[model samples]
Target: MNRNILKVTLLAATLGLVSGAAFAEDYRQNPFTLTYKNAITENVVGKVNIHAVNYALNGVNIVANVYTPANYDPSKQYPAIVVAHPNGGVKEQVAGLYAQRLAEMGYITIAADAAYQGGSGGEPRNIDKPSHRIEDIHGMADFISQYPGVDATELGLLGICGGGGYSLKAAQTDKRFKSVATLSMFNSGLVRRNGYVNSQTDTIQERLKQASEARALEASSGEIRYTGDAQLTDEQIAKLPFELYREGFIYYGKTHAHPNSTFRYTVSSLLELMSFDATNNIDLINQPLLMIAGSKADSLYMTQDAFIKASGADSKELFLIDGATHIQTYWNPEYVDKAVSKLTEFYGKNL
Candidate 1:
């Protein structure tokens, strides 16, 4: 038992470091660590440690972390939120930071690893599936509300990067979430199928060929290599597909890097993502939706496009964070604060 505890502690430390590397801070400086060690107050009310779980969602056991406000009570229920981590991110990444900060502001925030990624259960680790990813959010909502001190009635969701699009899908179909908000929303499926809005179309033949080859490689080697986001050195980062990659690494690869995380994901998953389109049913979304993107982010167009198509949304708003890049919004104090303020106000009024 002592050895087991030691092993767990060691694993936690490693995971912590990895998460710290890719996420919550400037890698050139402190990297992402447990920086919010100071006092924080929120609904549950006190300083609480992050909790991990193997939650069953979408026929899979997904890993997640819940940040309950300090001073939690058994009697009083508190408002809660489901925070979906961005693509290639886990609960311990910046997503968790957002959840923790929101909890500090008096909400029960749960950030979860998408199915088949991070500590979550999926056959092919790091595989991105739209249906299952949506289920991950719904399942998080189900799990969080069931916790003893949480108010099941007051529920909200925040999705970061690719997670944003999935959150929209969940809100549209499940309707369990009273309010939904996104930060630097990336249309993963759309981007995969058609490069960056109208950039280019990757035909089905090539997609299938890639998936088929990836599957065979997995079968022969009994190992599935991932292509999540591809890591980069400071020099390589500068030469990435887009400037966002250079910046995204600061958020997900360096500052928030978790030992369990890799920039690479399963190539086969791209096929599914290419075909996936979270905004197809945007017209069906009725709950209040807040989509925030950086004005200068090349990815901004995706969120904007999604906002324009949603037909029946009674309360919907698209915010462009001035002078911010796509990934920079994750941990940027000014950007994140602006986002949280808007989110707090929205959930306060709507939820």
Candidate 2:
């Protein structure tokens, strides 16, 4: 029950490794409240337009942003892609960035805040469970496939970070996705159950016991306890074990932060997360697949592991961005451009 061990356990679950004293942009001016660079301020007549939307997902209001291609014609058919955000990430961060970029390439894209997180509605926020996260992706596919001008038969999917892991699970049987792609893909279950690169393997049972007690507390007293919420100084961030966690603090905490994004989740979520694995039944995915990761990312093993197990993919390719670490791929322009170019090619051919 040491506080530090609990903090690390929750941080691994939420994927927001560093918290406290983080910087966030003033997004009051942007109607969409987008925190990414060069976000759309206004809808141009012939340029891509972002539509803030909300819909019911199992009685909860799921908020999302759907981007329409330039000169979009409702009557014409257009392929669509669903962009899933990373763990502890909102639709306005990297998910929105990639959604907008793909829209510019003539693909209608949707980026949604997962239920219980971001702008979406859910009680006892930040659950971070595999079932709910996976359901969110499937819900997005359900909504976007019916959107105006979207060719239901030509739908594609793009998942980033933890979202990438859920996307693989959704595409496994959904099959509506003609193509599937992941960026800096993170296997949330593997990390939650085993710790980042199995760093906390020795304490797996202890954590599970803690998670059970947390769940019991929530059920009996309705008092929810959260974890992974910490206030760390610059020095602490620098000392993080993995480069991904270190850079993640700067990316989600400072360089590109949103008010809705957080690093905390109900401690009980680990009860489910501890046993979940994104790679479970991964070979069920039969569509074309493209998995992208950074050559230098400490988290690259998750991508490599999932890619190798995706034996059922009609076609599969693993592309590594040179010199890019896990978080750099989220915002660095050079790396982003390379990723977008490759995605454009992949979706163009497969979707």
Candidate 3:
């Protein structure tokens, strides 16, 4: 038991460079180890990390990070991947980690904060409409495709968590993404409408009513309300019943905390979220599709459901990481390595 505990502790330290306790209380003091201890930086060898890139999308200024492979040269074209961050997440967290890893694997990658959240410019901040989020993925494809040394024909896409759902919707319409992949997919629309694991089925109508009311207030220029905005103590977070929510709070609210990651969306946004379904019209995606999820993640159902609905993809696969939970796939070294290895192979074959 002692050896097992030590192994886990060693794994966490190697992934994020902070002790488990510091993950909850001293995130800021840690050495910028959101996912990996030696994340790409300006001075890093074999990789380059560009920050605060400004781009226009539907009249909004979007902030994004672009990662280029080692020894990248503009004269030489390269395959690229656009990574979409999870809901309430920023470009600097899990998205950046994958972007960096992919970059190291010889693919140019971009991870952008959604238009209305993080460091991006949008009014009534934290608005989490599905259309807007889907547009963000499309926007990344547009911006990154034109970047120097990027071969537009070989472009690929990866979306994590809620972003995974949006990617499915975006790839359905945007053929620019030659290959599409999702990690630990979260069906935001299904959850918002029926609740996690269908636990709120009885409250569906009641919750829709609240969403309607919130939208009405927004239209009338009244105070904008928000949901999923809670301030919980460490103990409270630890005691949360669901592993996804519990680990999410620790990742976005504590250990991997960033100033722009609030993890809240305007309550009115649910009006759109509830009505949007990523699996709707999923058959339009004819490109290669890869859906990855943790074997033990409760959220695996989302990936499976979406994969089943994506009938039009000529080539598709569902890969699962053994012994991992949803959030664990984000930072757990063993799981992350497995996920990235699979992604590299998928993109290498498809793109």
lDDT leader: 2
lDDT of 3 by residue, 30-68 (tens): 354344434653546545655457799989999888888
13-129, model 2: which lDDT tens digit per residue? 444634454445435557888877788989999999999999999998999999999999999999999999999999988999999999999999999999999889999988879
**Relative to the unseen true structure, what is the Cα RMSD of model 2?**
1.6
Identify the runs in model 2 with alpha carbons over 4 angstroms from their true place: 10-14, 17-29
> What's the TM-score of each model vs. the native?
0.83, 0.96, 0.90
lDDT of 1 at 316: 90
Put down candidate 1 lDDT per residue, 1-351, tens digits, no spaces: 134422322121111122224334332232333322231223222565456566677577777777777676658888999999877676766687688778878887888777777777778666767877887888888899898788888899899887898988888877778888999888878776665544444344555566667778878987774443333356655655565655665544555556555545666666577678878878888988889888989788888889999877878999888998887687677887888888888889888
CA shift at 263, candidate 2, in angstroms?
1.6
Provide the clash count, candidate 1: 30
Off by over 4 Å in 3: 1-21, 24-36
lDDT at position 43, candidate 1: 25
